[model samples]
Target: MSCLLEVTALCKTYRKQHGLFRQETIKALENISFQLHAGKTLAIVGETGSGKSTLAKVLVGIEQPDQGEIRLAGKVVTMTNYRKYNHVIRYLFQDAERALNPSQKIGDMLTDVLRFSTVLDNLQRQQKVLESLQQVGLMDEHIDFYPHMFSAGQQQRIALARALILDPKLLILDEALTVLDPTLRAQIVNLLLELQQQKGLAYLLISKNLRLVRHISDHCIVMQHGQVVESGPTEQLLTQPQHAHTRKLMGMS
Candidate 1:
């Protein structure tokens, strides 16, 4: 399979205030690198502040790297790159509430996205929207409800539906299932696998949930202090983690 995305020696730094006037440059991500293949999931696991979220932001063009390069589909990524990639790369944020608009009904929000992208006609767009909702196990009636009216899991499904509406090539899930129940998480995970088989969708899954990641991801990369410490086939790395950090992370005896 061809590489859908590649990050080479990526780095991000920020200045932090330590005192009234003193400040220091803190390296958030240092020389990070990875490749995501088409129709496969690559999970990046680490504790909070391991730069996983930063990496997701970079991938979705929300943050610029101070150094290194990111290539999407054989071309280098730049600020202007998002104009094209906006249709390809979408990020499912950790917070479902943040992902949805408080003022708009769910259906209207999705309808606007379809209208703005202009990918389908009004009738076709409505059909596709309803199909996406159904895929997430939501009904047409729920589409007219406000996001706050639904449970966290239901809101998450709506978010998933919105992301899938564009038929994106790469989905960057930033702790997306954190707010969901275990059973619901399993449902979404299975849905993702089904979608991958059906649509050839690729995923960059960022999560702290080890079991779910191991089950869903074909490739795995363990990050520490903003760099990948262990990476390989998910089964190999998880079953017999060579790195001490990886072993410690999974709590293997």
Candidate 2:
């Protein structure tokens, strides 16, 4: 249960042209801070434009924070050294189909990850790919299938397999479960929890689904206007929200 990720005073801003000469500054995230531990899940729940997605992108190195510090396993993470941490922290996007290439077979796609990130030979990479597929409840037969060949749920499983291929300690899920139906979402949640227990994985879930956050997360933070309005243990925060924004999110009067 050691701390695996620490984010402090994270800030991000963007300037957009308003008119021919005027411009507007938008603060996406302001002084955001949090901690996540091994084998735990931390859920960020917010409305659209609340900066949840921005935080995900920053954590995964897709975007740089204007001012902040990110530490993984007590080591500072900067854009310059992000490549060293890429294998230890991975991202799973919401759209599995869009994240995957339709023309590539699942096996080749997975092998490519190992081919670049690892020193394993062809035989070793193939073995690792099969192992990763099995970790997400996929089978050997799925290795030859293209992205279009699977159902929405199965495609997500494949994406999960790819993320776990490198045996990452932290997985940032940017609305990864939002696209699935109730039943499929439940299945993926169970699978994710199982994987966490088995591999001691940590998850940073960016989502708007309150029910999913309550069920799967150990702690929850509610964001509004690009700031955290409330944060606490998941059950406590959900059942007894303190902030007006959080109450509104929960449909409370």
Candidate 3:
């Protein structure tokens, strides 16, 4: 598969306040680089504060990297022009419920996304929204429900439906399954895999869960202190981790 997204020499830093008139420069990401191909899964596994979320933010245009190159479909992309990429590359957050509008119906949520992202009129948008709902195994009637009414898994499905509405070439799953139970997590994992096969969708999965990485990702990168210390095929990296941090993360140490 040809690469859909390529990131090179990515670096980001932040000024974190420690005390009055005292601020510390923290490196959120350092020379991070990776690529994702069509229909492939790339897992970013690391401990908290390891810059995994930072990387995701950069990719989705929420955070701008001070130094780096981000190329989508072999074209350069900067934060200024990033909104144009949203339809092709969508970002999904960890907290599914919070990602949705508490006051909005499911249909409204989906419709709102469609309205902002596409040129479809109301009748056309509604048809697409219903199609998206069905694609995620949601009934059309459930579209009238609110976020609080669905099960955790169904909420995720609703989010998934919204992400799929644009038929994005890539979906960035930033700790997206962290809140679910094991069974629901597994179900979402399977749903993601199935969606990849069905839609030729690529994924950048951000999580600390090695088991989730092993189950869904084709390739994996392990980060520590804002740098990638180890990376390879998911099974090999998990089974024979080369970096100490990777071993410790996999509980091998």
Candidate 4:
């Protein structure tokens, strides 16, 4: 498995104002570094304000890093060139419903990506949409339904379908399974695993759920106050966390 994504010395910050004269510099990420290979899963676990979401945003090009390097498929990724890499990397947010358009039918929503990003004709784009739906275990009939017409799990499947429509090498999942019920979560986990095996997809999972992280991730990184406090193979790190923050996060302290 080749290195699908590499991030090094990544840093991000924000400025906040208090009163009229005082300003605060918030460190959202600091010296973050990691690598993810094709068909592998890497989990980022941290409490709120730990910079997990900021890292995801940076990787997906929603936010730019103040400093650091991001390489996708061995090519440097920057704000100026991120558009060229969009088809190779995709993001799956926690809120599938909110991420989707309520007005557009499923097929239209999926087709829109192809329409704007590729040179596929109408018939070719339709075929690609149908293929994407099938990949996510959706039937062709469901393509005509609106977002509200589907259950939460199905809506998520639709979101996954759209993400997969581009055949991306990496998928950044930011608390993507947090809202689902236990049963649905398990189902989606299984589906995601299947898809990864079939598509050779690399996953960068952001979550606060230790159990979920342990179950799904091959490796794990624990973040606190914008830094990676501890990291290792998932099973080993969960059972034998070295950092105080990691132990506290796992309820081991």
Cα distance off (Å), candidate 4, residue 200: 0.7
- lDDT of each model, Cα atoms only? 0.88, 0.93, 0.91, 0.93
- lDDT per residue as tens, model 1, 1-253: 7998998999999889988999998788999988998999999998778899899988888888999998888889887867678778988988888889999998899998888886688899889889989977899888789999988888888998998888899998999988888887888788889889998999999988889888899999999888899999999999989988788889884
State candidate 4's TM-score.
Answer: 0.98
Can you write out model 4's per-residue Cα lDDT over 1-253, one digit (the tens) per residue?
A: 6898999999999999999999999999999999999999999998899999999999889999999999988889989988778898899989999999999999899999998889999999999999999888899998899999999999899999998998999998999999999999999999999999988998999999999998889999999999999999999999888999998888888
Clashes of 3: 0
For 1-253, candidate 3 gives per-residue lDDT tens digits of 6889999999999998987999999899999988889999999989999999999888888888999999999999987787789888888889899888889999999998888878899999989989999888889898889999999899899889988898899999998999999999889888888889998999999988778888899999999999999999999988889999999998888
Candidate 2 lDDT by residue in tens digits, 2-48: 88999999999989997899999999999999999999999999888
- Counting clashing residue pairs in each candidate, in order, gives 0, 0, 0, 0
Candidate 4: residue pairs that collide = none
Off by over 4 Å in 3: none
Give candidate 1 regions above 4 Å deviation: 119-121
| Model 2: CA > 4 A from native | none
Candidate 3: worst 10 consecutive residues by lDDT? Answer: 78-87
- The order by descending TM-score is 4, 2, 3, 1
List where candidate 4 sits over 4 angstroms from the true fold.
none
TM-score of each: 0.93, 0.98, 0.97, 0.98
Query: By summed lDDT, which 10 consecutive residues of candidate 2 come out lowest?
Result: 244-253
